[model samples]
Target: MTRCLRRIAALALVLCPLAAAAPAAAQDSAAAEALFNRGLADMEAGRYETGCEAIAESHRIEPKLGALFTLAICESRSGRIAAAFTHFGEYLAQVDQLTPEQKSRQGERPKVARQEHDKLARLVPELSLALPPGAPAGTVVKRDGRVVDSAALGAGVPAEPGEHVVSTQAPGGPVWETRIQLAQGEKKRVELQVKDTSAPPAGGLSGRRAAMVVAGGVGAAGLVIGGITGALTLGKKSVVEEHCGSGIGVSDETACDQAGMDAADSASTTGLVSTIGFGVGLAGLGAAAVLYLTEPTQREPTAGATSRRIRAGVLAAGPQGVVLGASGVW
Candidate 1:
C-alpha cells in the first residue's frame, strides 16, 4: 500500500504540469485553425492576396504541411510562380512524413509544381554587366543606386522585365554608364567603357592664371600710385623753386622758403616709396606669370580686398603747428 501511494504521488506531480499547459496549447491550436479557415474563406471570397498572407502567418505560428500547400497554390495563382515553385520544393522535401492517406489526397501536387518551376525559369529575364579593361580595381557596381555584390558582378543576375540603369564614378576617372530596357525571356549583356575625364585642354584659364590676371591689375594700380607720387614730388619741387629759388624778401616769402625746405625733404621720401612700390609690382607680376605657366594644377582662389594709404599733398606750415602731408586712402 505504501509503494502504490508513492507511485500515485509521482503520477499526480507529472500530470499537474501537463494539466496546466493543456489550456495554452489548446488556445494556440485554436488560433492556428482559425487563421487557416480564414485563409480559405478569404480565397473563396476573391481576396487571394490577404488569403496567401494569412496562410503564411498560420504556417509561421504552426508549421503544418497543409498550410504550406495552400500558401504555395495561392502564390502560383497570384502570378508569383517563382515563389510558388520555391515553397513547393520545400513542401516536397518534408511531404514524405505525411501518412499514406495524406499522400493520396494531395495528388498531382509535385507534378504541377515542377511544371511551374520550368515555366517560370524560361520567363524570367537576366542581365549581365561587364566592367571594361580600364575600369579601376575595386570599382563598386550599382543598380538603381543600390550597390551590387562584388561576388555577383560579370554574371547573369535574374531580373524583372523593365528598364534598368548602370553607372559608376564621374570625377577624375572615366564615366562608365549604360541604360538598358529588358524584355521578357531576354538575356541582355552590357559592357561599360570609361571616357577620358582627367585633363583640361592644353590652354585654359585656371586659378594660377587668374592670379596672374589679378597681378596684372596690381601692376597697373602700382603704376598709378607711382604716377600720383611723381606728381606730388614735382609739385613740391615747384614750391621750392617759387620760394627759395626766388630770394625771400617779404615775410610771406620767408615762410614760403621754410615751407620749400620741408617740401624738398618730403619729396625724397615719397619718391623712394613710389620707386619701391613700382618695382615690387613688376617683380611680383612676373613671378605670378611664371608660376601660372608651370603649376601642375590650378591654385585655390584668393579672396579679399587690398588697400594702401598714401599721404602726398603738401600742407602750409602754420605758427600753431607743423602740418603733415595729405592723409587719405589710395
Candidate 2:
C-alpha cells in the first residue's frame, strides 16, 4: 500500500504540470488563430503593411504551415520582394516534412510558392563593391550602415530597389563614401578609393547659413510686395480725392459720392496690404540677420566627407517680383 501511494504521488506531480500546460497551450493557439484571421481580413482590405506584421507575429507565436505560406504571400504583395522570396523558399523547403495527408491538403500551394520565389529572384537588385588597386589591407565596407563581409566585396549581393549609401574605411585612412540608386533587377558596382585628407574639408553652407538665405529671400519678396502695393495705394488715394471732394484743392465732405466711397475703400485695402507686407519684410529680415550673426564661424566635416557647393541668389527679376533660386552639388 505504501509503495502504490508513492507511485501515485509521483505520477500526480508530473500530470499536474502537464495539465496546467494544456490550458496555456490552448490559449496561445486560440490567440494565434485570432491573429491569423485578423491578418487575413486586413490583407483583404488592402492594408498590406499591417497585415504582414500581424501574420508575421502569428507565425512567430504558433508557426503553422498555413501561416508561413500566408506570410510569404503577404510580404510579396507588400513589395518586400526579398523577404517574400526567402519565406517562400522556407515554405517549399518544409513542405516535404509534412505528412502525406497534409501535403495532399496543401494542393498547388507548393507550386505557387516555387513560382513566386523564382519571380522575385529576378526582380531584386544587386550591388557589387570593388576596391581600387593598391588599396590598404583591412579595408572595411558598409552598406546602409551595416557591415559588409569581405568575401562579399567582389560578388554581387541582392539589395532592395532604392537609394543606398556605401562607405569604405581603411585602417588609419580617411573614409570614402558614395550614394547609388538601384531599380528593380538592376545591377550596380561602386569602386572604393581612399579619401584625400591633406586638403581642407569641403562642406558647403552650414544649416544656419541655409536658413539665412531662405529668410533673406522671403524678406526681399516682402519688400517688393510692399513697394508695389504702396504705389497702388497712392494711385487709389488720388482717385478717391478726385471723386470724394468737389474738385481739386477742395475739401467738401458732403460732396462725396458712391464712386468716391468705392475709391476710398480700395485705397484702404491696398494700404492694409502694404502695411502687412512691410511688417513681414521687417520680420523676415530680422530673422535672417539673427540666424546669420549667431551662426558658427566654422564647421567640421563629417566622416566619409563629400564635397558640396550650395549657391543661393536672386535668379531673376520681373514686373511682378524677383525669383529666388537655390542649388546644390553633392
Candidate 3:
C-alpha cells in the first residue's frame, strides 16, 4: 500500500505542469481569436479606432498573416493609406507559405492596395471649410466674391497652395468671410460664421418707410372699396324689398323689375371690384411685410478667422465628404 501511494504521488507531480499549461494555453488561444474577430467587426463597421485597438491586440498575441492583412485594411479605411500599403507589402513578403486558397486571397491584396494607393495619390492639398455649430446645411460657399463648389462641406477638397478668401451665406443671413493660406500638400480648415440679418432696425422708422407707406395706401384703398361695396349691397337689398313688398304682384312688376335689375347689376359690379381691391391689398401687405422683415438690422460686416492645416503623409480628422492631405514630393 505504501509503494502504491508513492507511485501515485510521483504521477501527480509529473502531470502537474501539463494540467496547468493546458488551460492557460486554451485561454490564450481563445482570447487571441476573440480579439481578431472583434477587429474584423470594427473594420466592417467603419469604427476604425476600435478596429485598430483590436487588431493590435490580436497581433501582439499571435503574429499571423491574416491579422496583419486585416490591420492593413483597417488602417486604409481609417484614412492611413500609406501605412496600409506598407503593411500590405509586408503581408505579401510572407505569401510563399500560404495554401492555394490563401494564395488566391493574398493575390487580391495587391490589387486592392494599388487602388488605395491611387486614391491616396489623388488626395493631396485639401481645403476644409469649418462651419459654426447649427449652421444650416446646403449653405452656399463662396470665395473672392465668386461661388465655389459646396462639395468641400463633405470632406477635404483639393486646392492650390495659396491664400484664398472663403465665405458662406444662407437665406436671411449676413455673408461670412475669412482668409486662409495653404501650403503644398497641406490640409487647411477654415471656419465660417453664418450671420443672421433678418431683423428690422429699431427707432420705429428707418430704411423701410417707403415700402410701408405704399402698403398702407393699398390697404386703405381696399377698405374703402369694401365699405362702398357693402353700402351698395345694403341699398340694393332695401330697394328690392321695397319694390317686391306684399301688395306688388307679378302683373304690376315692370318698374319693380327694372329697379331690381339695376340694383342687381350695381351689387354684382361692386362685389367684383371689392374682391379685386381686397386681393391686391393683401398681396401688397404681404410684400411689404417680407421687405420689412428681411431688411438688415445692422450694416456692419464683421469677420472672425481660425484655421488648421494638415500636410501630406500625415493623418488628420475631417468632417464628412472629400478627404485631403498634402504629400511630400515623391
Candidate 4:
C-alpha cells in the first residue's frame, strides 16, 4: 500500500506541467477554431469588416495561411487596398510547401492573390513617419493602438486611405501625437511634435473670462424675453382699461364687466411671465459681473484680446405688478 501511494505521488509530480498547460491549450484551440469558422462564414456573407477582424484574430491566436488569405480578400472587398496588398504579400512570404489536400482546397488562390497584390502596390496610399534629429532614444511609435516596429518605419507603412492617428513616446518623456489624412496613392510624411501646455490659453477666453462671455449671452437672451413679456403685460393692461374704465360711457355694463374680467386674467398671466423674465435677466447679469471679477488676473490679455468683449449693459422692463427690470450686454 505504501509503494502504491509512492507511485501515485511520482506520477502526479511528473505530469504537473502538462496538467497546468492543458486548460490554456484547450481554450486557445477552441477560440482559434471558432474565430476561423466565423471569419469564413462572414466572408461568404460579404461582411468585409467583421470577416477581416475574425480572420485577423484567428491568425493572431494561431498563424495560418488560410486565415491570412481570407483577411486579404476581406480587406480588398472593403476597399482597403494598401492593407490588402501587405497581407497578401505576407501570405505569399510563407515559403512552407502545402500538403496535397491543402493545395487542392486553395488551388490557384495563391497565384491570384500575389498577382492582385502587385497591382495594388502602385495604387495604394502609404504614410511615412520620420522623427526629427533630436528625438529622444527609446521612443516607440504606434498607429492607433498597435505598436509599429522599426522595420516597418524604414520603408513607408501601408494603410487605408483616411485619417490615421500616430503616437510616439519615450520612457519618462511626454508623448507626442498627431492625426493625418491620406489620399489614395498619396505618400505623406509627418514629423511628430510635443504639446506645449505651459503657454496661456489661446483662440477664445478661458477661466472666468469664458464664464463671463457665456453669462453675458444668457443675460442678453433673458433681456429679450423680458422685453417681449413686458410688452405683452402692458398691452393686456391697456386692453382691460379700454373695455371697462369705471363703467363710464361703456355700453352694456354686463358685457363690459365680462370683457374687463377676461383682460384682467390675461394681464395677470403676462405679469407673471414678465416678472420671471426680469428676475432671470437680473441673475444672469449679476453672474456675469461675478465671473468678470473672479477671473484669473495672471493671464494678461494677449495681443488682439479685447477687454470688454461687450460687457453687460442695461435693459429695463415695466413692472409686472410692482417694479420690473432687465440688464444685459449685446
Candidate 5:
C-alpha cells in the first residue's frame, strides 16, 4: 500500500503541471485566433496600422504562415516597403519548409509572395552612408535608433521610405544628427562629418587677413624686382652708348660692333625682366586688395565658412613673353 501511494503521488505531481498548462495554452490559442480574425477584418477595411499590429501579435503567439502573409500585405499596402519585403521573404522561406501537402494547400501564396518581394525590391529606398576620410576608428553610426553595422558603411543598404534620423558619435566629437526624407526607389548618399570644436578661440589673425598679408608680400617683392631691373636696363643703355657711337641719328646696325650688339641684347633682356616684374607686382597687389575687401569683418576660423577660392595665372604669348598676369579672389 505504501509503494502504491508513492507511485500515485509521483504520477499526480507530473500530471498536475500539464493539466494546469492546458488551460493557459488553450487561452493563448483562442486569443491568437481571435486576433487573427480581427486583423484580417481590419486589413480588409483598409486599417493597415491596426491590422499590422494585431496580425504581428498573432504571428508572435501562434506563428502561422497565413498571419505572416497578412502582415506582409498589410505592411506593403501601408508603404512600409522594407518591412513588407522582409516579411514576404520570411513567409516564403517558411512555406518552403512545409510538407508537399501543406505546400499545395498554400495555393498561390508562394507565387504572390515572390512577386510582391521582387516588386518591393524596386520600390524600397536605400541609404548609403560613409564616414569622412579622417573619421575616428571607433566611430559609431545609428539609423533611427538602431546601430548600423560597420561593414555596411559606404555601401547602399536598404531602408524604409519615410523620415529618418541618422546619428553618429566619435571619440572627443559631438554627436552629429541629420534628418533625411527618403522616397520610393530613391538612393541617397550621405557623408557623415564630425565637427571639430577643439580649435583655438578667436584671438589671432583671420584667414583672409593672413592671405592678404601674403599676397601683399608677394606684390612688394615683385615691385622691388621691377625697380631694380629698371635701373639695370638704364645702365645697359649707357653701356650700349659707350660701346657704339652715341650720335643721335646712328640707326644702321653695321655701324655698331659686336660689343654694342651684346650690350643691346642685354638691355632687351633686362627690359623684358623689368616688364615681367612690374606685371607680377601689379597682379599680386590687386589680389591683395581683393582679398582684403572680401574679408569678413569679424575674426573667426575659416572652418565651415563659405567656400572661397583665389586664382592666379600668367598668360604667355611666347617663351620669353608673358602677355598678362591675372589674379582674382572669388
Candidate 6:
C-alpha cells in the first residue's frame, strides 16, 4: 500500500507543475495578443510610431508571423517603403505554414507588397551629365541635387527614369549643371560645357616670347665675338708666316723673330677667345632648344560644356557624349 502511495505521489508531483505552468503560458500568450491588437488599433488611428512600438513589443514576447506582417503594413503607410518591402517578403515566406483560413485571410498580402515596392522604385530620379574632353575619369555625378554614385558616371549605367537636375565636377574644373527629362527606359544624351580651370595663366605666351628674344640676343652676341676672334686668328697666322719664312736675310732675323713672337701671342689670344665664344654659342643654342621643347602646349577653348552619361550598371557614353566614373558621386 505504501509503495502504491509513493508511486501516486511521484506522478502527481510531476504533473502538478506542468498543470500549474500551462495557465501561466496561456496568460503570456493572451498578453502578447492584446499588445498586437492594440498596435493594430493605433495604426488604424494614424499613430504609426505607437503602433510600430507596440507591434515590436508583441513580437518580442510571441514572435508571431501575423504580427510581423501587420508591422510591415504600418511601415508602408508611414512612408518607410524599403523596410516595409523587407518585412513583407519575410511575412509571405512564413505564411506557408498557416492554416487554410489564415492563408485565405492573407491571400493578397504578397501582391500588395510588390505594388508598394514598385511605387517606391518609381521615385528614383533621372540624371543627365556632360563631361569635357580630357576630364579625369571617376568624376562624381549628381542628380536632383543629390549624389548617385561616382561609378554611375560612365558607360553601362542604365538611363535614370524621371525628371532631375544633372551635374558633374572634376578635381579642378568648374561645375557643370543641366536639367533633363528621362522617359521610362529611354536614354537621353546631354552635354555640359565645363570651363577649364587647368588652363595656363594669360601671361604664358608673353613669357615664352620674351625668353625667345633673350635667347636670340645672346646668340647674336656669341656670333659677333666668334667673327672678331676668327679675323684676329687669320691676321696672326699671316704675320707669323711672313716673318718666319726662309726669304728673310741675317740682318733682318732679329726683327723678324720679334714679329714672329708678337704673332704667336696674338694667335694664342685669338684661339682662346674663339674657343670660348664657340662654347658659349653652343650652350645658348642648347638652352633655346630645351626651352622650346619643354614649353607647355596651347589648348583651344571648347564652345560648350563637357558632359557624360550613365548607362547599364556603369557610366557610359550617351549619344554624342562622353562617359566617366569614380569612387563616389556628389
RMSD of each: 17.5, 16.5, 20.4, 15.3, 11.4, 18.3
lDDT of 1 by residue, 74-124 (tens): 876776654676687788777667788887777887566667667767876
- Report lDDT (CA) for all predictions: 0.68, 0.79, 0.66, 0.73, 0.80, 0.65
State every prediction's TM-score relative to the real structure. Answer: 0.41, 0.50, 0.31, 0.49, 0.57, 0.35
Clashing pairs in model 3?
Answer: 154-320, 154-321, 155-321, 155-322, 156-322, 185-326, 187-310, 312-326, 312-327
Report the candidate with higher TM-score, 1 versus 2: 2
Q: Which residue pairs collide in model 2, if any?
A: none
Candidate 3 lDDT tens digits, 159-180:
5556778777877565767677
For residues 1-330, write the lDDT of model 4, one tens digit per residue.
999999999999989989999999889979998998998899889887888899899989988787888888888888989889988888877624766687777878888887888889887987877665666666788888788886776467787888787877766555666677788888876665432334244564555576777777877887788789889889887777777755546565435567778888887887777777776677677778866664433222122344443333334444442232333342
The model with the greater TM-score, 1 or 4, is 4
| Order by TM-score, highest first | 5, 2, 4, 1, 6, 3
Could you tell me the C-alpha RMSD of candidate 3 in Å? 20.4
The alpha-carbon deviation from the true structure for residue 140 of candidate 5, after best TM-score superposition, in angstroms, is 3.3
TM-score pick, better of 3 and 4: 4
Question: For candidate 6, what is the lDDT?
Answer: 0.65
- Per-residue lDDT of candidate 6, residues 54-82 (tens digit): 98888888897778878888887876554
User: In model 5, which regions exceed 4 Å deviation?
Assistant: 151-155, 171-173, 195-330
Q: Whose lDDT is higher: candidate 3's or candidate 4's?
A: 4
Candidate 4 matches the true fold with a TM-score of 0.49
Span of ten consecutive residues with least summed lDDT in model 5: 296-305
Clashes of each: 0, 0, 9, 2, 0, 30
What value of lDDT does candidate 1 attain over all alpha carbons? 0.68
